[model samples]
Target: MTEEPARRRYDSLRRTAQAQQTSADIARAARTLFVAKGWAATTVRDVAREAGVSVPTIYAAYGNKNGLTWALTDAADLSADLSRLLAELESAPEPPRQLAAMVAYDRRLFERAGEVIVLLREAGRTEPELAQAYREARARADDAHRQVLSTWPPGALRSSIDLQTALDIYAAICNIDVYTELISERGWSSEQVEKWWCTMVIRELLEIPTAAT
Candidate 1:
């Protein structure tokens, strides 16, 4: 083959690889757009155009817009990280320490959940499946918190208080929506929020008397 023809063939191969890479990139971009703009507003053509590829490329790689969405959702693990944080709190040393740890853990968890929350909030408007998934994930988190509170030190205030009540209290303070509203909407500093959360948890759940400095 002539050198010119050989170079043309190599360039064609390079273009094919670049197109495949663009498909994956488009899938990710589509996820963000879908979450930010909603599924009804976003289009496969928009995703392909954003990723600098042809619409046919996206169809070839993802098969369809729904396939791309499913791929993105399956790839992300928003629930798993929250569960891991709760597990860490359960393994913590003592009630006081666990309460403090849980506060910090939840802060971190919310940071990760921020994107997922946006997706869920937008998805809930039109997608029943997505809404159901969000609810199931939230229930799992609540159950995890309840399990952690069950390990609270004995003789805590309102020892008569039911586990559900304790869980509710913790959930109220540590909830991702509550945290975002306080930290982002209300402009509370993270340190202040964490300190207050830990104090509340310590006093209510652990029943620790605060020492005067």
Candidate 2:
């Protein structure tokens, strides 16, 4: 009985590892296809072919193409992953520094998944499922931003700025369109963008001069 239980544990661990690897492979393949072909044109068959898994596996792991899109979104979800950083933001002594750190953290996330996010925004225009997913993703980030904002002691924010405006500024500057504008189209380097992001987030949102300028 002891031997059988040990064997079962090993089998379970192996299956878990294999499942994680399979999901990673699928996500990687889907990301490539999405970037190359755009979300609207990329189909499950293409992903299955790219990932070398069956369509059923894709569906099983992530219900459909839109489901796959959300899986991608979840993988890149900034709110889901910030532990130490979030705590750091909460503990920061001033609002400007906290906002700067938050922007820097979110900048790294956008750097990783900005292309897919842009694709989803384009797809969202015509596809209802993707549109909903996109909105929910934004909501989650907004909620996180709000939580961080709430950590500020009273009067840390400018008297003129309200909760909603602060959240809006955070969302707009950190979103894909601005990223695409500065980093994608205008040819700003990642360093330039991150610097600008931190500065602008501090100035416009927190109403403070960035330390550099």
- Find the candidate with the highest TM-score and give its number: 2
What's the CA RMSD of model 1 in angstroms? 14.8
Off by over 4 Å in 1: 1-33, 40-87, 209-213
Prediction 2 global C-alpha lDDT: 0.70
Which lDDT value does model 2 have at 157?
68
lDDT (0 to 1) per candidate: 0.61, 0.70
lDDT of 2 by residue, 79-142 (tens): 2235435445534546777777777767777787776677677788988887887888788677
Q: For residues 1-76, could you state the per-residue lDDT of candidate 1 as single tens digits?
A: 3545434423432443344344556645665676667777888888887768888977887788765654343223
Query: How far in Å is the alpha carbon of 4 misplaced in model 2?
Result: 40
TM-score per candidate, chains pooled? 0.59, 0.69
Number of backbone-clashing residue pairs for each candidate, in the order shown = 0, 0
Which candidate comes out best when scored by lDDT?
A: 2
The TM-score measured for candidate 2 stands at 0.69
